[model samples]
Target: MSNYCIDIFEFGRHKTQEVTIGDVKMGASNPIVVQSMTTTNTNETEETVAQIKTIIDAGGQMVRMTTQGQREAKNLEHIKAQLVKEGYNQPLVADIHYNPNAANIAALHIEKVRINPGNFVDGAKKFENIDYTNESYLEELEQVKKKLIPLLNICKQNKTAIRIGTNHGSLSDRIMSRYGDTPQGMVEACMEFLRICKDEKFFNIVLSIKASNARIMVHTVRLLVQKMNEEDMYFPLHLGVTEAGEGEDGRIRSAVGIGTLLMDGIGDTIRVSLTENPEKEIPVANQIIDYINTKEGHDAIKKVDTDNYSPFKYTRHQTNAVKNIGGNNVPVVIGNNHFTKDSDYSYIADSSVIVSADKKEYPVVKYSNSNEFDFNNHELCFVKIAYSDMDDSAIQFFKQQNNVVILLTSNNSNSTIEQRAAFLHLRNHHVTTPVVIHKLYDSVFDANTQIQASCDIGPLFIDGFGDGIFIENNTENQSLVINTMFAVLQASRVRFSRPDYISCPGCGRTLFGLQDTTVLVKEKTAHLKGLKIAVMGCIVNGPGEMADADYGYVGSGPGKVTLYHQREVVKKNINQEDAIGELVALIKENGDWVEPS
Candidate 1:
């Protein structure tokens, strides 16, 4: 219930007001819960029930299913009955959008109901910009209250908890008109519904503000927590990064967003939205939760003055730029190369390379295992210090050089903590030389490599630690290694090199073929470096969820699309067949189009 964010060094979980859904208790002193959603059509009771069973059996503490309309809402009864018959009593959540009636019916059979405030009452298709006076807005609130009362009564009668979830991609036109699609808008959107719940004396509620962009997600959740504190409301928070794509990109994106908040002691329950089978998401969620809960040395790291930092916002810490490592330059990516007689330096082009001392490289940073390395090449030399090597002598050596960047390494199981503690030691000792975070993996950088690296290194970046990232692995594919490094940088918002698509993972509410449309959009626009294009599933969160995207292609209706320049709708209801072409044309018109090489 405290307003202050958790101290990164304290390792304390924030205690929230407990909300019970069935036998599952979340928030308060409960172990952080893991949850996932089924991708099958909710109306197909058999398919949904089977998926839910898989999710629960795969270690999901709770399972969610989309309930978009009357039929899906009604089918919840059958899903619950089948689940019970199969001896699975895990709590079920109904994910509702654009329909209060569905929520009303879902509450009767499910343990909890999730309503997107953006479209629960306001239709997603009606996206006209509205000029509202204070009086007019109050009138609109009155209408919303009327529409929500039936669902509220049903939830109260059934003892069902509710999550007044707000998606960054989806905000009502009124909220957009007033708040201009910001974190502020996201907080206010949830507050409007929370106010209604309070008026009805319904207190069993959770809150979430999700965004595809991790930076926005972190900012919004912090703001929501602060706002809730101001209002004396203590609701548990449900955290996730929506539409995090498949594979390593999805996992890293989800972890950077969700893990950042978890490190701050902010979430009660979490779901990692990977575009894979619902069951695939559970283990990743579990890994993140287990890592955070068991992560040691938060208390061991010496705390530095945070007067210059705000937990609710991001401002890159100012440090003297050492060559290409820091200062106003975007953070650099250092590719790890084994020092060998026949080592290929071709992959090291355009990137600062890390090589061992025996290699005798001039342009590359010479990595030495001991502190006895020559510091004469201060600008290009990096000394590798294991956690065991961290002592008064090592600290003094690093402090004395003042120009050689420190390459901190660890072989301990909790390497992230050890590596971070080294950084804390440097900062605390006022050793301002730039530091490149290095994590060595014994195996190849494959499918699981990104997850491990992100978990180990992403948090350090989120907390404003590294100057460059050096990943050491045996993966022969240089492009994959380089791309993954940059991806982590982009996901952390420390650097940007490619187009960031804020594409939503398709759901029942998706109006168009989300997967195909996202592919088409990427093909045409992925060359526009650093430009963010949101390929949303539907209009519900399309405009709002685009967050700070440079352009948007959101599904408006069946085979219909709406294109946006920034957050403003420039083209509405275009045929899906031509939407991509038109989006490209619009980009060309705006001078953002670049010919793909």
Candidate 2:
């Protein structure tokens, strides 16, 4: 049994207790739920209801709205009445933070209430470290539980399911003091409340552990399940990458985080958190669901021999250096046709390599379970082996071979996991051959292709499996194949050919034009390669939300913005029109700014 997955080799959904929210049921073999949160103000009943309809039409199985205080909490009654009046009976969930009374009011009026474990009775995040003795920590946990039990009781009485969501950026000062914003800290922050729920006999619970970084989001969710297993907790997971910005970047980021877990049979519900309209997020979530559904009944993957792998740690499997392809090199992206350095070129067989075969310039050997290669003569060679055809003999053939790189391909419906298992086998056998992940998509390069490639190849890079990627897709031009590969590599955090952006999907609390502002920030900063910039809707989770970003643009109020250099506030409450220039000035002052090429 794997800590991250129910069974690392077996392809199936992670079994969890069913949580009923009004008419919708989630987890435990239920259709993986698709969900989105509204950006419309909750008090505007008409607008909220209309947006809910649009979200449902766009395939949102459940809709969530922000309820910050008594005003928004009470307004839900009118919203619910309006939705029911229009013959729309979809379940409604209230997103609660920093208010227990709002959660109690929401529990009585809505189908579900989500409480941030970081805020519910926990000390506010001052980002200060408090060295807590064991006695002090336990006492604080007890006090927090005593305060939360009342909300759990209200939820139980109302038959309302509760989701304890742990956002990476919003971890409280107490939790962060000891665990320091890590995967273990995220799990424990959620678990303290879950333990209270258990003690109070409140069983209807769903859980979420999210981050802006796609790789961290995946790692924490995997670790959450592992920790839950140890504690006998099987709460359903709500998978998402918080603040995943709009357009293809948002889609690719969501896929890399959510798709990686879904491949391992984790996640009960998913939301593609985009900075655009909430309704636009549903179709992207649907695409990820449809793509992952294709992995269910594939040919079984062979069980790995010895798993010396750590789910919490990211250590690229060791391999011999093959030029710029592997061994501490950033993972390369390869196109089917000849391309530049980052976009490397590859040959499928000897027929195409015939011209270069004599010179052994870039020759490849197709393994038919035998090796007749002139290793002594060639300085370097790429050995291709069907991942499905690999066994002890194949591993033994390449175990001690020098000047060799492995090209892995698979036809199994198991998708990425099949290739993953092959990587494990090589690692177990002490093979240091650099590996390149290869996939052939029969369809043209489109939205599906972008999502599918990020899902398949991105995870390998996130988990440190493949040394390079070679993608073959039916497209009219080479740009489709080459462009998509670089995007996947960038999303995977294995390489960066563009500026990385993190922007939150705005909620009712957001008081500015988040979508347009995010676009503006991206347009201005897109040329800063390797720089991470965050465009957040509001300060509630903004300053903390950017994670490792070098700069942040946070909406502090209507027509106002705040600029941050990492976590320190550089400028507070500047006019929206002046924010971009001030941000650029801050970047330049910090020695991070470079002129656009």
Candidate 3:
């Protein structure tokens, strides 16, 4: 669109030809795009090609494979050749860093090259980690630019679409030396790179400013978009929360971070970074797109609506409903999932109140750590809970809460034993509390039996639960449950346990005792509530992951360590002999650590 973003985000105003990669296109005028990064090693051509085919078969239109070195780059042509031979004509992107030559090479076969300027530029030599208040800072800045111009040109001439990616790692040492590794510093550095690309006549570009911090990630995107808008610019923004772990938390955090931005209409493309297989990312990424553009009669978004009902739009109205539900003291079980105490549950606790129940009157209870159900002093206390669709009492309980609860139950509620058991749970629970019974696509025969026996007679329910309140009823697609739950939790006043761990998957290169350090750190800090700490391996992704954490310890060499707090390096070159004690002491100094036992 605007000239301000002409180079960094060219919308092709004159032509607006859909920018297709393989078959996926993401542009101002193009339809919503879904993409994923290959988890296969670039050097493994057979495995990589196999994975790419699987991705395409699974509905991925655009894919990215890493090209970390010349070997991988050399192998990339074969990888492309193989894909072409196999008739796998999807758009592929080469994720290359540091080596500009690699970028030039990758551009030969891949549809795009994702360049991290922070890593590509040579750090100013004269400006070594010293305070700029000293001298030589301005001179160093001039020298840094002198070095980066050539690489920028090489990319421009290749007709490559540069993904201006800014990460905590590979930060231009000059920026780190001046601003430290903070979100603002990262965003500013990325913008500067975009400015450079524009100056060098590189107009085909996509932009991403990523961080591991869920909060920071969301905020940075918001700020970047705001800044771009102020300057009257529009570019396709890639969304991701890096180092966002595997399994439950990773998915939840990515959904929260990416979902928050998409809701604000800030993201154009997205990648769900996980430590697991890249194929898993495709389904999650697609669901996010579907969730955002949910509307009646929208087929593409609706296809993933496994529940047969139109996808639910997360709007201000649902938020208002949560607010309305929070004003009650009735324990609300929103779904059939087990309620685990001390896990900071989002679905099954009354979060409206913060104080102890002993001090309050009837219907008052201690709020779950999640704080998802904040209530007024006089409002009815309702603790919302959820379970699988096969739990009948859980499903029945849905009706009592005005069907506000999420019901994940079997589609056949009365055909068999499992279905009947589920029906009983929903039927019984619906008599008193708010419950919404979501039907499962699978056979509920066995599942219903399990739920009936488990919940109906358990000590927690032996005394029998009571019907409490009823709110509203709507069946949600299971594919979007995780995203919807997170969306709902965010709308509520949910709380999360802080000072989490970010450990690496040990590889051959892993050294400096990552396993012991991680275990020791977690054991030492176990009781330290609300303090985020990371024990990471070599400086590669460690610093970035640690930036998202409150504090971190990273290995540089045998018996050498670097400590970071609040994303800024506080200590360097500490001997391994004193590393543990020193790190613990530093953490204690910040008063974020639980007293060491």
Candidate 4:
């Protein structure tokens, strides 16, 4: 509950009531499930079934499809029939928005229904800030309860599990009026609906609170778990970074958010929402879960007081400035012999290292706990310590140092747990010496390794632990290691070296080709760093979902696009062919455009 997992310093899954969804049962100590969703139209049985097959074949444990209307909801029956005929028994979840009837119909046909509480009973968000006193608010809650009771009744009758998903950017006006569009609002939105389900004795429920910002997503999920536990309600959580985009950006972002929670033992299932083939997402999901599961029976780590930490928001571990490496400085990336080779992770370190080290500007020196520590005078003193060495005595010594930069590392099988425990110990003792997280990966170079590296260190940074990161990967591709370091930093909200795209994986409601449009948007906007851009498939959740993005490109119709500067609509209904150009023009008009070198 305090920037932690079930066991904090060790490993254990969070406990929750079991829920049945057709062939798939989730929560409690059940295996962390991997899931994917189709991009095909719901009514297209052949294609939808085809994608679901691909997803399942790729180790997807469950599949979800968009059901926007009654027609599509009815079509699910046919899709389920086709899958059954073909001997596919995996549960099919229907993603419903603003459609209780669709939820009712899909409940009759599918195994689960995912409804966004923001839109379900509140209807489409008018973006209004409604004035409500206690009486009015209570009246609104009664109306919402009445509206949702019927859906819960149907789901209970059909044995269809319901996921009351709350997206941060898309909170209902009623909730926003009171909670002000924050994580609390997202939780309240879902809790309001969940109370209805509980009152109706419908316990077949899972919950998801998501955000495009990895930090917000992790924070909200952690807060949600605490809130539910306070009420003695333990609903299973479905983990995802909603609208996480394609390729490396998407992978890093998803790993940062989803992997952090999985490490905390909070999620029951996950979907790496990438704007690619549904099958392609399954491997990423599998890789993330695999890396996290490796720490399940890990070696014990020494526990420390966590009253200094909060999982819901980030406040960098307090430290005094040591030149450019700590205390208000952006996280620094240190070079190692392996990753800093022909093309090192440093600032051209081969030549730069000699000059910088010779000048005594700042230097990295490995410290041994067995020997009495030596503090020599230099412009800045950088000392490294293994996690095992950061005991009470070492922390007391480092606490008084104004020029110490601690390099923290771990060799345990459960590297993150050990390192996290060490950080907590240091924080509890009020040791503010800047800490740079260091991890060595001797594993093969693959998606699993790439994702594992991020997951191992990501949670520390997200929990506001480290000041810098030092990485070493035993891969011939040094650039891959370099990219991962920056990716972890960016994904942790510690730094940004590339523009972030809050692009959603297109659903059946998507109007045009989503993948290609995302590529085009990235191609034109790659040079525009420090900007958050979203390429959403439709207006349904586009504008609201990418709420933090500096610019948004949302699909308004078939081959038509809408552009936004922040949340304000700058232009609408531009042809898809010219949408990219218009977006650049819009960026230039707003002074965010920059030419690629």
Candidate 5:
């Protein structure tokens, strides 16, 4: 069971009925608490507080103003007074990147102080490219802890919370060297700060583990939550998909990444970051939190909300598309139960096993035996549904059949016949197999949801017509044993291929239209099928990274580019203006060109 009955007081700062910051309560557990940082000069009190109030009125729960210099620190008291006089009570957070003393001074008026451990570690800012052979990461971490103590002490004295945030691009050399620029490395780095907080007996630390990729952000949170949950560190998780670009992509990526985790009951708090207006953060956060809490089977959390906002209404079509595999005609299904987990299967064939949430049983065999299934193949899986119960052998037989499409169904009382039809349409469009229906219900919902197995077989149906079909439960259904046999009869033909467009991040030595060149190549080849092209900044990792690309466009210098075919440098000094065309020619020469869109 989820620990949804959380005592909200344990996270960060405690606030009740609006603690001091301008209408913001750090611990009130508001449905949507917004926070944003100012890009303005901190010393500019008139401009800074004007921006602060604007953000406050825009529903910003917290505002952080950069205190980069000593002079900026001196301007803190003035900024604080101006904010107070303006009647803004939202918590003020200080963004201190370099100077620790700035954190000490800013804490006088701010509610929270954030410091980059990488910045203060060695009293130096190196290129951040790690030296792997150094083997002195623990030493550097010790130094970092030493540098952070005074700053943390100052914050403690001032009753301020600290954010232990990590940046992937600007990582500490020691961490990067040891962890090799991965999310786990970043988590370890944040954990170092948590260790200090533990030692100091401070409980006011909020942790943020961020990476540039949306996928990485999700994975990082999973890692952090997994680590913490195993040991049970219940610190508040501040969510952000860092360096997420402005506009729809940013919004969608943030929503998907953050929403996925929130659905899994992960995030304690969130920040929707974009290069857009700072005020835009609140609405986005509100939408996400509301969507998560009010979602199906999440009603208990929803009832706690004062606003009574409706949950996100995704079309059944959109929700069904969530599990499309290789654009096949048949959608795959994993038992909605423990059989879905990758860890349970000793020999994973076309099936997955879900680990039981209750682990009172001693071994995997004992657990499987206790359940209503036979673990003969062990590769065959079982999913728990509202009414369906089958022996483990029967479940295995069902899984062994390749033709049986498993559509994960829900037990929502409101799930309409139209929704089921829409789901079927989506499944058939994505996968080329007969779908078997299994309806799983939330423990809270009534356990009477029924499954209807329908076979509407033909050549691939168009999306519009499929969209129009209404799904109803047919009285006739195939037996589990028969379904398994059918699945075995059909072979698995779907293959997972990598997506196109691999562009290298530009470095200092990168010359000649690096960013734009890559963009142009992606745009030109956006419609191309199965073409792997590399747009690299320089020759250092260009050849290595681009090794698998059918064609490569590399920037050697200004007004000059190098083209490669199959990792062998075919031509040098290709004019930058003609580089795209020439790269296309190389792709064609490699027999991988699709006609341009």
Candidate 6:
């Protein structure tokens, strides 16, 4: 059994039992695989087949389709037939929730079946709170085992692999009554089903514990690894952050969660769930996997006081709050630019300034390499220091200035490694000044900039190392850089400047139009800063997946939507036409609504 902690600094991949799905294999010396799901209805065999082809052509090794009922389950045969006829032998995974019979049908036709353990036997929309004793909880597990045995036999007979995926939002009433919606509860939910699979002598199993919150997602996955090792079980893990909204926000969230685990050598296969087309997700997943592969054994930073820190849990390191940074304050974002006489500073207001030494704009922070700069006007000064130029004088100067924040840059080939090592040097010398991670890139492509910046800056935040982030890219789109900065912060759960939308990537079970409805929800509620609003496609992922959303807009049926106020159903089955208006009225009824300026 592997006995390694999930710490990124001490790198070692946890060896796992490799399971093959169709022609593709994952775990144990295999390269990390990329997967995506189709947003089309499963009954539309032609459209489903077309999307699968598009995903495969765009670099997805495996494709998944939703199966919510008997018809969708039966249609998997036709979908598989069409793909084989089109000369594609890519593996097809059936995504099942709340239907054991559908899972049985899917197992016979597909290469793999992904069942949500929280809802495989229990129905969604039946979230009743029950107080169960220990004996009663064991009885519930026994009942679940009876319902799950048939599907396990079918999968075994057909050589079908099983993914016992547990979502953070959808924990069963029994788990909630005991564990109260936590990472421990998530791990227990998966272990319950895994035990049944083991008892049935079915070993072809994969596991996933997903959450929209990156902190929860990271913690739960790490806890699951520890528990599995204790039990001598080595199932490959599929990593993702669910309902991570569209565009740069989605990419950054996926990277912060998935990239962090991958740095610790965790995750076998991954899927980046976005609110856009399925094909658009492939490139982002590839970028994350490719970047992690390059930094497998490279020593990025020197180890500090990690003995007091738990790699399986998150605990922010304590520091004195200098102005609006450190201690209880959220990590800040600093922008790097050379201000000119005609430059417009009004467009960017949220970011703290990081102007050059010669500029006289009186920025909140100044960046310079020389020790003779004027530090009287600014409350915070970021003295730029390269690793190669560090000496006794530089160290002494940093110790003398009470208002100085180190701006670490690199001239070495591996800038990430150099900058991180510089932070360790300060810690070793007892330098307590706060450090802002500054990375400069020459890439003109927006995707490259996002990936590189996230890889460099994400792990530092995850490790409780940085106080703020400053990114300088050569692209002409300034808004892209600004948005990416906040995206990284939001993903890290350090700060929130705008509304957070918990939108599920669409599937066959989605009622009404998901993409269009998401756009309308954002149009109306994006102004509510710091408010977490969930726009779910169906009830199966609605109440549970919207785990911590303050408000919810969930699809109940065709042209019918349900609005939720923190898990309680406030309005049930309202017309989809008037749902947005009612959601606004409900927000106003509470004290959360604000007028857009």
Tens digits of lDDT, candidate 4, 1-597: 453346778778899899988988799878888899999999899999999999998999899999999999999999999999999999999999888889889989999999998888778777888898999999988888877888888887788889898988678888988998788888888888888887888899999998888898998898888888877799999999989899987898899999999888889999999999889998898889888888878877877777777778888888777776678888877655443422212422243221122233355566664245455555566677877787667877787677777878888878888888887788788787888888887777666777988789888889888887777664677677777888888888888878988899999999999999899889888888779999999877887876778999999888999999998998889999998999888989988877887
Per-residue lDDT over 361-472 for candidate 5, one digit per residue giving the tens place of the 0 to 100 score = 2112222243444444443223222111223453454335442223323343322222234233333334332332333232221101111111111001111112111122
Computed on alpha carbons, the lDDT of every model, listed in order, comes to: 0.77, 0.84, 0.52, 0.83, 0.50, 0.80
> Order of candidates by lDDT, top first?
2, 4, 6, 1, 3, 5
User: lDDT at 583 for candidate 4?
Assistant: 88
Model 6 agreement with the true structure over 388-441: per-residue lDDT tens digits = 666777777777777776767764444555565566666667677777677777
Model 3, C-alpha of 363: deviation from truth (Å): 7.0
Better of 1 and 6 by TM-score: 6
- The residue-level lDDT of candidate 5 at 70 comes to 74
Ranking of candidates on TM-score, top first? 2, 4, 6, 1, 3, 5
TM-score each candidate. Answer: 0.83, 0.96, 0.59, 0.95, 0.55, 0.89
Residue 334 displacement in candidate 6 (angstroms) = 1.7
Clash count, candidate 3: 73
Which tens-of-lDDT digit does each residue in 1-597 have in candidate 1? 235566545656776899999999998989888999887788888888888889998999998888888899889999999999989999999999888888888999999999988888887735567999999999989989998988889888899999999987778888988987688988999999999999999989999999887877888898898888888888999999987766667788898888877877789999998756779899998888877776644435544454444556665655566656566766666655433222222224345545433443434433444434555754556566665666677667766664566666777665665665666666656667677777777777775666666777776777677787777766667566667777888888788788877776666666777766777777777789888888887766677667578898888888899899997889999999999999999999999987887
Query: Which ranges in model 1 have alpha carbons more than 4 Å from their true place?
Result: 1-5, 122-146, 177-179, 195-199, 229-232, 296-299, 338-379, 383-403, 408-432, 442-445, 474-481, 520-528, 568-591
Candidate with maximal lDDT: 2
Poorest lDDT segment (10 consecutive residues) of candidate 3? 310-319
Candidate 4 wrongly placed segments (more than 4 Å)? 1-5, 338-363, 369-374
* Candidate with more favorable, higher TM-score: 4 or 5: 4
Per-residue lDDT tens digits of candidate 2, residues 118-237?
877763567889999999999989888877888888877889899999999889888998899788899999998888888888989999998998888888888889888989989899
Top TM-score prediction, candidate number: 2
